[model samples]
Target: MTDYEKFKIRHNVITLGKKEYDIAIDKFVRKALKNKDVVSIYKIGSIRYPGLSDIDLIVFLKDRPKHFSIKKFSIKNLSAKEKYMFMHEIFAVPDSMGGKIKLLYPIFSLEHLGGKKYDFIEPETSDFIPFFIQEYVKGYMSWPDRIIRKGIIDEREIIPQVYATKYSIGIYQKILGYSSKEFERKCRQYIKVAENLREDFYKTKKDERDKIIIDLIYLTKEINNAMFFDLKKYLDKNIKTKPRTITLYLGFRPNIVVFNKHIDYMEFLNIRFLPSNFSLICKKDLSGAFNDEKLEKAFEKRYKLIEQYDDFIYKNNLGRFMMLTNMKSQFNITSFIKKRVSKN
Candidate 1:
């Protein structure tokens, strides 16, 4: 069988009874293309993902004609709300020739239609135009290519799909922008928040620390919303944490940290009091449950330490302060030992 046939068969098997959805997409594209202003229609989202859910169709227009309207089309069985959603999606196409050609669409449509014009900030003879023009042109062209090839299209159909699929990539690049490094940095920040929450859980007394822990959990959700990337999906599929507490522990600090001077150890401390699992606090938790013997030993150790410093803490209301100091010391020493052993 041909590659396309094999792919179609494989996709059918994976999706089971959803083959009709794929067939419907092809029909929708053909229907959209019949309209005079419709230049092309590309299937995006789950339809392109083979076995994934949901289907998104990107209908591209050559120009925003005064006469053209999605509402005029007579596609059946769709509710008024669905029709409006579809029309909104079509109306979002960018106006610039380059943008139209690239076909970048995001959750929201592009607001600027008249091409990204370079402003003459200084004088007409300034050299900024050349640099701006060069950067814009490079971005305008390269973005569409990367999105089509890397982001969406399956490898086997790359040749047949290239022309039609170009718009998909263009839309994706415009939606995601072209900054993997910036994305990674933002992800790291959220992960740090998650790690901090986990650490706090382990260190704080459950009954006394509800307010701060709850706030940290809320902060994690806010970070997740702000980042709005796929890191949450990674956390969901790979890790186990309560939905309420997900924001808190989704990207907890690395289970182990290699000691390095450049590391932001202070930031780690600031977030460390947020709470976490026993495994994060005690290395021995990795093996199994804390036995009677281990619990007795731990209590004895704690009693001795409390006996040694209880008077000072009571006099100063330094209970929380002492706990934090002890937590930091343990973390640093464990981190140092781990690094030393890893090197050897």
Candidate 2:
């Protein structure tokens, strides 16, 4: 089929798919407005995507007295299937919005909307809709800039598979015990596959974007494993102790065991690292953990975890770990540990 004909087919399918969704949303909005409590219905998420898979609806309700408020608001008045579809659109808002709303209000605070069904009251103090829309627009507008900023391409041209090959080789070195020869061969193969996948994605050949993302994520995990292993080796060689019990705490936990002497090790090395991209990590009991401290602790923890087990730090390394401690306090555990561990 011609490109125009293909586009028409896709557009028609999407339009037909959204009919029921649009009707449900429209009915909900009308009913909400009639109650004289709901002030607005802010549509978010893929509804705004040029090619949306599903609709997202965020209805803002007016605040009511606690005694009169419904505990669990929901669209139970609607048919069971309708309610199910609505719930799906409602739950994913936080993740889609980048979890920024959590900083302002408790997630449960909005529970009334889904909890009390048709008789729920809105939040007393929530400008989340406006903020959400603003942030969404900002991100949408910056998409072009962000893609270009990757430094891989100057303009919107198809990316070469060579980059993917390099990335794959890097992954092999970091994750697998592949020798130079093996790594080179695998990298070349990866590049060829990546090239084919890229073309497929652009041409809409067979929904290859998701496959590419999955493969890339796997490769990233492998790289992380390699880094952790290397760090573990370094620690074993440098730290002198029999049965030195080293615990690698992963996830958003504020705990670290370091030799006192290694307190100044990061500064001595003058290297900066990021623990996790999602949340901040701090030393336990310390108030304000510097970037460097977090970075060092992150590296140390990663190394320890990898040495201990392949999956020990998998969850933490998935970009959700947070350290909760102040590394800038007058406390001096670094020196103490260094002295103690050194003697062993």
Q: Each prediction's Cα lDDT score?
A: 0.32, 0.34
Model 2 C-alpha RMSD to native: 17.8
Q: lDDT value for candidate 1?
A: 0.32
- Per-candidate alpha-carbon RMSD to the true structure: 26.7, 17.8
In model 2, the runs with Cα more than 4 Å from the true position are 1-16, 48-52, 63-77, 87-344
The worst-scoring run of ten residues by lDDT in candidate 2 lies at 318-327
Q: Candidate 2's residue-wise lDDT over 1-344, tens digit each?
A: 11221111121212224556667777766665555444444454332211123334554433321211122234555676565445433321111122233322213222222312332323222222211111212222222233323423211122222232343344334333354565456555666665565434445533344435335434433433333344345344433342312222221221122322223445322212222111111234222222234434433443332232213122213112111111212234446445655776
Candidate 1, residue 208: the lDDT equals: 33
- Over 4 Å off in model 1, which ranges? 1-17, 46-52, 64-67, 74-222, 225-344
User: How well is each residue in 156-262 modelled by candidate 1, as lDDT tens digits?
Assistant: 22212222223323332333343467644544553454344333434555333333333333333333333233423422443333222112222232222111222
TM-score of 1: 0.26
Global CA lDDT computed for model 2: 0.34
